[model samples]
Target: MAKAYWVATYRSVTDPDKLAAYAKLSGPAINAAGGRILARGLPSQVYELGLEQRTVLIEFDSVEQARAAHDSSAYQEALALLEGGAERDIRIIEGI
Candidate 1:
């Protein structure tokens, strides 16, 4: 099975406190679902796009694993914590 990559490009943050709260739950949530965070908050030099923000990348065994990881109860708990914490654009892409 092809590995799946989860990417989240952040735009803006509203509440730092909530972000902290979400962070507290993220690791356990992913690990429990067999997902491992490859890199997070890494800087990207985009000379083409001419803009940048925090980009988070995670790797999963498969698309099903990726989706399952994000849809799990623990992740949902984290999501609930981050409800208004930040503004983000998130997606899961299958890696070639």
Candidate 2:
């Protein structure tokens, strides 16, 4: 099976404190669920309609694993901490 990738792009961060709180929990939660963080940071350059915002890329063995990681209770808890703190778009894609 093809590998999967979790791509998260932040649109805007309204509350730094809340985001920070979520970050503290999310990393461990995701790591425990077999997700490996590949990259995370603001873009060095933006083109087209892209905004220079925080982005994260995580790799999982499969799409199912990626989905499981997102749906896990631990991750759900972290999600709660992120609610309203920022706007983000997250996608799970099959890797080549």
Candidate 3:
């Protein structure tokens, strides 16, 4: 089966404390769920209607695994902490 990826793009961060909490909790949750963080950073350059937001990319063995990770208790807890902390768009995509 093709691999899958979890992509999250942050539009804005409104609460630094909550963001920090999420960062701490999400790492372990992702790792325990067999997900690997591929990238996390600000865009170096932008073109067209480029957005000024942070981006995160995570790779999983399969789409099911990616979905599982998001639904896991640990990740759910992290999501609770991140709620309202930042405006983000997250999605799971199948790899080519």
Candidate 4:
């Protein structure tokens, strides 16, 4: 199976404290589910339509694994903490 990459790009953050709280729990939850964090935080540089925003990348063994992690109860809890905190675009991409 192809490896899967989970990506999250933050468009805007309205509540820093809430986002911080979500991060604290989400990190552990994702790690426990066999997701390896590849990169996170603001981009070093931006070009074209890209904006200087926070981005996160995580790797999983397969698409199934990535979906499972996202659907897991632990991750759900973490997600709940992020509600109304920020606007983000998230997706899972299969590796080449």
The TM-score values for the models, in the order shown, are 0.92, 0.96, 0.96, 0.97
Tens digits of per-residue lDDT for model 4, 4-75: 999999999999999999999999999999999999999999999999989999999999999999999999
Ranking by TM-score: 4, 3, 2, 1
Deviation from native of the Cα of residue 20 in model 3, angstroms: 0.5
Q: Where is model 3 more than 4 Å wrong at Cα? A: none
lDDT of 1 by residue, 1-96 (tens): 799998988888789899889989987898889888888874756777644777788889999999999999999999899898799988999989
Poorly placed runs, candidate 2 (over 4 Å): none
C-alpha positional error of residue 77 in candidate 2 after TM-score superposition, expressed in Å: 0.4
Give the alpha carbon lDDT tens digit for every residue of 1-96 in model 3. Answer: 999999999999999899999999999999999999999989988899998689999999999999999999999999999999999999999999
| Tens digit per residue, CA lDDT, model 2, 11-50 | 9999999999999999999999999999999998889998
lDDT of 3 at 14: 98
Better of 1 and 2 by TM-score: 2
State which candidate, 3 or 4, has the greater TM-score: 4
- In candidate 4, which residue pairs clash? none
Q: Rate the local accuracy (lDDT) of all candidates.
A: 0.86, 0.98, 0.96, 0.97
**Cα displacement (Å) at residue 20, model 2:** 0.5
Best lDDT goes to which candidate? 2
